[model samples]
Target: MPTKSGSQRKRTALLLLLALTGCALRVPVRQLRLPDKLPPEELGALRAIYLVLRLADAETASPDKLSRAVALAAEIRRALEGPSSRVVAYQITASDEPADYFIEQSSATGVLWLNLPATEPDPPPQEVDASTATASARPVEASLKAPYHFYAEPGHRLILKDSVSAAHKSTSTAENQRALARLLAANLAKDLAVHPMTLHRVVEEGGEPELKEAYQAAKEQRWPAAVTLWKKVSTALSDDWTPLYNLGVAQEKEGRFDLAQEYYAMALERENSKSRPRKSTLRRLRNILATLNRLAPSSLEPAKGGAAHIPAWLRQKMAVLPMSNETVDIEAPQVVRAKLHQALASRGYRVLPLQEVDEKLKEIGLTDGGQLKAYSTQEIAKALDAELLFYSRLMDFRVIPLGIYYERVVQAHFTLTAAASRTLHGTRSTAQGAADTGDVVLDWEEKVQYQSVSEPKKWAEALAWQILERQVSKILKVQLKEETEILVLKCVNKLPAYFNP
Candidate 1:
């Protein structure tokens, strides 16, 4: 028989061993790793549609050039047919068949007309300095015209017309034209396809090994494996929201959107009051939900003639006028205006082409945006045959480079006005109504700044950094185009979805 003291000592030793084992087996905290670049997704309405390619000026185009265009169309078809999107099974026919014919016969949902000119436009006359009479004097570079035009109509409703040009430095016109054709086809395919969304990793320092392994699996694109690991981690750390958020991301990548949304909501519930991860998580959830709603099967149905079928906002014709430039950058206004036009069109707005608007303004002797203050909103809208007028101003556009620092600034203001507002009682002046009357429906402004700083220890490093900065600036137009796009989207989102007459 054991003594009472010895029995008590044995029990204490067993308890101590168990405590040590628990501590050793505990999972440590780990942080998530993010990718360098995030890929963009295409949420446009052109997805999963059969496309028909036809030449508008086929009678005038050369046989060789027409054949090349047909080949390019075939290439575009192959590119657009992918796992994510079977958007375009295209047919290239020289027949003058109408869009209705293809739609009825071949189940085509869209028609793209290639308006290729018979021959390249005559290059501008080269200029030579009269003072330099020597034959060695170089003539000024001549400007080249766009090689092709693409006009697209989905469901017989004209939506997009884009001119294709090549900026290739090659002196061969044929090579440039070929490049232009390929680029046009590529752009069309991109517009119609859904690209993979880039995954965003939420990193926390000193996280569990299972959590790290799950993130690594996601980075490798093994989404199923990642989900499994994330599930284990979430089960173990029920209080932690990070694993739940990651599981949502994995589910989204696997196209299980409903599951992803649920996970996101649950993660939000578990998230602490801290704003950072919560804000980011909320944004992701909203974007996914928006995408889901937009891609719904009901939204894909063609609108009928009935008022119930089409939204009131879609019936309104909007005219986006040339933006007023208050900045020193001469090209800023046009760039921003173009981006705004595309954004509105993508959102299903019936916006007039900028060219048509400009032509109408030209008829009224209004060549500049500053001159718009002279005319009433109704008069300008009537001229453009629009029910609404969108006025924009580029307040600031600049890219400044310091020793080792690069800075970009973009700022813009937008205003939407109802064209049917009654004229003021007192004033015979058309400009007075524009300034005084409360016709402005939506008004907002956005400004953004992007800066990058680097410290170089050696001459080689400094040289490389300078070169990289210059390249980035040149490629993205001073890195301000994206800022301009973001501002434009913000403005567009504020516009009323249902317009009341």
Candidate 2:
């Protein structure tokens, strides 16, 4: 029983009150938080599978758009490279290989198209003459069965819907596409690298208050408090690496590098005794060790009267000739030469660079010949302006694989002599008298075994280099103080003296 104006005003006030009430009752958004570091276990067991990635635009033959498409593909490749990439190995190939998956990035359409093997049964491989080798001749050619076109759903596809068209509209479209490609790569990596999450070990009830307190202090960035608590726990649980690791972290946070290094080393030793230490812990320890090495005084500095006062023949410019390799591997000589060069340089000797020596060898017709020693070192040295020369011969070199482990065996003989001294540096032919034989300086036989999951050639090369490195160290007469790290050995020998010096 109110007037019309009064009734309308009352209804408006009620509507306003209800709107405010609804706004107050609405739920707040939950904050999104990501883990500080992705756990390694999440990647699961590695299964070797090849993923062939090819750019779709590469087939179009459009030079105008090819550059942008190639750039996008490169971005994807960079994102895919990491430790977690153990899941899927990638190679860009046009040749028909038994590929497990094929990913084609179409930058023109801004879509990542995936192709799956067709459900239809594969055709049998056809035999062909070896001279006419092609897909038909390969045994696994059937595995390259035609793939079914996969239409990626919204989640799987990189939808740069307007970006492709915008390329014609603006010059910055290529940059936008590049940004989208990166975003897509990150999303794919995250999805593919799923692994088990590590649970925090904190007791809710009947737990040691001191341990929990230490964790809380560390979390709160209270380095001093955390260090004190962790140290007490370390004493109590002398065998545990957890408290020790925590102590190291706290010390590092507190800027006490020396103490941090000690704790980390202790933690690493303890953890290594049980099993492989955490990757993060191993990385931190290695970094700290490198830093310590940098800070430590270098022992590579030549002694006061070391090589400086050596006889001129030994002190003057030296040359290391490539070792003669009987092995089938063509790279053995190059690897040995590199190791020798590194060793010679550390001794404060003036050794001609490898390329210069190679050029001189080519000019003297010693680049490839019957025997390494057959080449006249004196003539080569005269050509190279060097007074001392090193010659080595590999008697045997083999890398044998035993299951997952690789064993590299190397046997070699070396001789260092005056490049120009006829009495000390001459070599005999089998037809000539034995009195023409050169003076042999160092002869070594190195055999080493190492376990590696990588390719056999790489593992063998690494072991071979180690053998050469140790041999060089022995020749220099320096005590190997740090076995874990290879130190450049000092040169301590009197060889071909420079007549001029």
**Leading candidate by TM-score:** 1
Q: Report, for every candidate in turn, its global Cα lDDT versus the true structure.
A: 0.57, 0.43
Residue lDDT tens for model 2, 325-426: 776756555655566677667645578898898788888777742344565555666777876666666554555544335444544455555443332124
lDDT of 1 at 269: 70
In angstroms, the error of model 1 at 296 is: 26
lDDT of 1 by residue, 366-398 (tens): 887777787878678878999778888788888
Clashes of each: 8, 8
Q: Can you give the lDDT of residue 381 in candidate 1?
A: 80
Instruction: Estimate the overall C-alpha local distance difference test score of candidate 2.
Output: 0.43
Task: Output the number of the lDDT-best candidate.
Answer: 1
> lDDT (0-100) at residue 281 of candidate 2?
53
- Candidate 1: where are CA atoms >4 Å away? 1-309, 422-438, 456-479, 497-501
Residue 174's lDDT in candidate 1: 57
